[model samples]
Target: MTASDEEMPKLLGDCVHCGFCLPTCPTYVLWGEEMDSPRGRIHLMQQHAEGEPLSLPMVQHFDRCLGCMACVTACPSGVQYDRLIETTRAQVELEHPRTPAERAMREAVFKLFPYPRRLRALRGPLRAYQKSCLDKLIRRTGLLDRLSPTLAAMERLAPPLGRTPRLPERVAARGERRATVGMLTGCVQGEFFPGVNAATARVLAMEGCDVVIPKGQGCCGALSLHSGREEEARAFARRTIVAFEAVDVIVVNSAGCGSAMKEYVRLLADEPTWAGRAEALSVKTRDLAEYVAELGPRAERKPLPVTVAYHDACHLSHAQGIRSQPRALLAGIPELTVREIADPDICCGSAGTYNIFQPEAAAELGDRKAANVRATDAELLVAANPGCSMQIAGALGRQGVDIAVAHTAEVLDASLRGLGRGSLVQRPQ
Candidate 1:
């Protein structure tokens, strides 16, 4: 469908020319270009609404946006920029045709990133490459980015791979059952960082919950949905709803997946067959930190003296309005100090595949973030999104900072089990 076929939603008018979003937007802070800010994009949407043709330049302006939703959070008018951007992107995907190179790169990303089996196949070779010092040699020589910028960026962002344990279909509650939730072990979370999901299950079970690791679960349609491949995202959403089936709640460890799943109702709005089911799934979905906090401290938390800086994933902080929940959960840990990084509202440029798509900008934003983290002088960094952890870890590595990074769940698991360190995965030596 083209712009002529549908009118732009009235939500676009809510901007009120508010400059409040200017400072909050990542791209605006970096480039200071009017075409890249939220207000500027809304103006372009207005032009399209008024029958101005969608030009390639307009698409570039939209493409430059990180989609971090910082403007939405900063706006007092409560403008729904998130919905506007998604709608515009769906139009872009349908109406615009990219050059062969750009198209192929996007296709490769969608094909590979959303599937677990393909990524699972890559774990062995990637681990060997890192362990054997090949990765170090390549980074030292500067041959990687020259070979293929995409591969080089991906390699740098790749997490430390280990023998991922298989998750059971059902993990029984340890003490007394408080609530039953079907866990969405995300594609990347399942294949690349399975330990986080395993830790999640253990912590959930310890907190008096029957954690069901439903089989046949796949991507929660976050990548597709965020990128405006509406039909594909909808299909993934329905599969998740079908897989979970009547659970008390749907718990997610990944922030991006949880944000997309929570919007299942809106994503499936056009489908009569699955719309109600999508609503049900959306209502029951909760972030791991959210659910864990509600369940309260059921198990023993052992002391581990570590100063941890909590990096807010954009989706979790801006999209989901979750700031204090994870911090509250972390504070429950004995002797664990929570330090706030400078410019907490800014993104580390890992807005889904933004780091992969716009590597240069991602690197700059990443370096800025890593520098702020370094100044914190903390021993550990905690982030909810795997993409953030991957991006931030790579940035810190490049800065020659050796501070370890871990998911919020892994930290909780370490405290609950009385384990001493090594729970949080660190960069390759």
Candidate 2:
């Protein structure tokens, strides 16, 4: 092994061939394929560490993984599948040569999704397409599916275009300022679901936080890091670290960004120059629910009487161990009944860019998750991550389920302002 990958063997050895992760693994749960399971993937990683060639089939298994870190949560052995998979992916990108078609598709996704400006530029055209009802006509005909499944998944997963409001650089606390914090306006979250970021800022300010939003901040490299583009992820991490270095605490609304940002220490471990900064930033980074739960509620929550199913975003619940905070926050709203989805641990198949990359498997998982949500019979579905919201929304749309999906902050923001349920809950079109 090269010096860069010297840790793989030790990480690989941590797995004891346990079957514990199988039930929680989305791919394994879907297919029951041994290689698709976490233990099975670790077995492949072990073979690779011992000098076996990185074969295409083996790489496919890794790529099929959702990287939800549910396995990390399931493992009693405390195996670091998160680190192992990430390391293997970086190696895959370096050593393996993908077919031209797959490479081009991945290249397009990496190019468009990671750049905030590019995504923002898309808003105008996308809004026009949606407004003109052309998207509806095109989707109705299903031409995109025949053209490209990936593109079709993109179309299916696109959130309804709404008013894109500009967030202020700072939002002062409403009453007594308990703390000053910086917020991460993520690429997808900022461009597609601007409402979540707006609500995040408003909720934080209401909770007695002076929210600071640094200008020109883009992706935190969560997409790159999770997908195994190490250098690209590092560059984004560095930019983010520099952008929010002065803030006492960093708050993230999207679960994927929050989880990835919290792992900056490992992402930058090879670079001595950035190691300390990365660690410091990771230490301070918190999910909105996590931070808010820690800060406790200062603003009085007006009644938002509605039954809602809380879809646990894997990154928030499994990766960040934030299962209760969101539930608590939702529960705090008097008369708001929180119903639980059937398989709380299973992912909704929106692991960063996993839904786009592995559309077929993601679709199956999304379908399964949607069925469970349907069983809840709640008036609305609530999730923290935008990707989950979009994925679930798309699945529900496909299944003709009309339950609306809202972010936790959006719900809390509505309650704090004494707004009606219609203000926050929105059905994806």
Candidate 3:
């Protein structure tokens, strides 16, 4: 159903214009304009709802937003910026015509991300292109010369592709345990960073919880929803809820997927049949770091001598409000030194497909983030989100920096199992 002109006003009315969100908003600082900030966007929604024409400039301001949801964390007014922005963008897509190329790209992303088979099929080509020197040749020839800067920035963010790690159907607890959690094998994470899944399983097992990586479960549809494929996202969410129904908890290592899974209630809100079930499923979902941290003393520990820097994934810190849990878990390792990267809350510009879609802007943000990470001089970079790990790892790799980038759980699990240095230094193949 289309959003009515009336509904916009009701949504806008919720924003009290407290201005607590300004400092956390990236676009507001970039443009230094009130209209670009969350409060400003809410005002624009109000105007558009009340029959005011949305000018091209107004729409451009809205498009410039990274949708990192940093404002949502800072809003004392409980503005629900994510809901407002998503609904507004949906309205924009329906009412305002997009260019043919833009529409095609959006359609392509929707078709690619929500389907696991297609994503797996593309991996071979992606790996071949990267390894064949063809990627370098494209850069050297300046074929896509205009996109070089953006591509260069993204290239720096790519992680080395290694063997994909698949978790067992069911890993019984080592001694005795009553808890079992179904792992949400995310689309990109499953294909790209399987080591993370392996580490998550090992860590969960150490905590005496049986880890279940159910087959047939697919992407959480975070990317699809972020890219405006709401129907596809909803379908995937329903499928995921069904697949994990028997498990006590649904564990997600990727912050982006965790954030999306937690919001399954909102995604299926309109569906009477699925709404309650989605909410129930969402309640059981937990980020890997959060879950391990909650398991308390069960997390095993050994000294890890590496100095590690933590980069907060936008979805984890802002979207999920999960800032401290990961850090506390990391600190539990006696040998691990946890250092903080400056501007930790800023987006690394790997907002799902944002790096691919808005490459230029994404490059600037990624570079800024990479620089901040470099300044820390930490031997290991730990992040909870797969996207952040890939983005930051790619950036560091491009600069000839050899510091290992890994998920927080991977690092912590190593410490617990007395495999700290070996697990981290040995590249997963």
Candidate 4:
């Protein structure tokens, strides 16, 4: 049975009410509300399991959870808070009703974010807006603050849009073919950060891997899955599985997308036909850093010669247990000083759509994370996940910090190609 089905109660029972999860939980740390913590949320889940109704208050607590899964990493008893919270969130999406405004806002987000074409269409307008001085005018006039916080958060989190270069269907390995891999050009990652995808393909090819990028691939259903839109997420997952069925191993760049793609086995467990296929795809799925690290770096690394603060995206760190691989990759480069950020375990508040939905709390958390990143005094910020990159960049921008944020793939790609440090690090204008 899936975690959302009969196994949910057992999963909930695993949490031992140990307070070890408290300090690591972003929401609990911010609010100090017991219900906001993992153990407290599990208590609420237990209450519902014991025949109590899933009340609005219970739903609110569940919504507050960033699903960062730091608690999953912290728990000594190996409590599966990740599965438990996902199941609970699914229940809330099904049983609870939000206000019309909330529903509309959520509807708008889902409609646009998951579809690659929709996001791609916005590239021209978004790029033009960034260049038109209107973006600066709105922010300078404090008009964003007067608008809805969600809109304000969206505006603030918009990365500097650039040319969206389309990737070819296949990139042959530069040398002897070591491995053939399929790449997931994620929805947001592809549209917002196309350079990262481009660099990923180049780096893979340089490392003697034939990169197969299926044109039909879209969202990995990460945003949907995280937000409890189970059916929508499954549909996306099913399509993704079929698109890359020919490839032996699937590689993902975005952390949240990677985590969700890896969870396809559980996400599609109830589906009779798709369950086995889901498991097959899940087994094949690997994060870009995780896959490259496992493949063993074959490409030459030139010196970057700069201090970089590596921000561990929650899904990468806790959901995927990919802490060292990225750092190890960076360490491979000569003269690359990897500075550790304070409170590395805490979420940057860009928990998928959490930053957009809970702007107030998200802003508070973002500011806190920004402060921690500043303390490192790193020249550049390197992150594996695009969301965390954007979140941290926006937060730093708010603080008048000009540090540039680059994906792990981008930095590695630069070093592999013998590009200058100026190629990777762009000081804000």
lDDT of each: 0.88, 0.90, 0.78, 0.90
lDDT of 1 by residue, 165-281 (tens): 998999999988988889999988898888899999999999999999888788889999888788889888889989987687989999999999989888877779988988888
Total clashes in model 2, counting residue pairs 3 or more apart in sequence or in different chains: 0
**Predicted structure 1: lDDT:** 0.88
Poorest 10 consecutive residues by lDDT, candidate 3: 149-158
The runs of at least 3 residues in candidate 1 whose Cα sits more than 4 Å from the true structure, single-residue gaps closed, are 1-9, 421-429
Model 2 clash pairs are: none
TM-score to native of every candidate shown: 0.96, 0.97, 0.92, 0.97
Question: Model 3: runs farther than 4 Å from truth?
Answer: 1-7, 16-18, 53-55, 145-158, 397-400, 425-429
Q: Which has the better lDDT: candidate 1, or candidate 3?
A: 1
Judging by TM-score, tell me the better candidate of 1 and 4. Answer: 4
Cα displacement (angstroms), candidate 1, residue 238, comes to: 0.9
Off by over 4 Å in 4: 1-5, 427-429
Worst 10 residues of 2 by lDDT: 1-10
lDDT of 3 at 278: 94
Looking at model 1, which ten-residue stretch has the lowest summed lDDT? 1-10
Q: Give the distance in Å from residue 146's predicted Cα in candidate 2 to where it truly belongs.
A: 1.5
- Candidate 3, number of clashes: 7
Q: In each prediction, how many residue pairs overlap at the backbone (N, C-alpha, C within less than 3 A)?
A: 0, 0, 7, 0
Q: Candidate 2 lDDT (Cα, whole model)?
A: 0.90
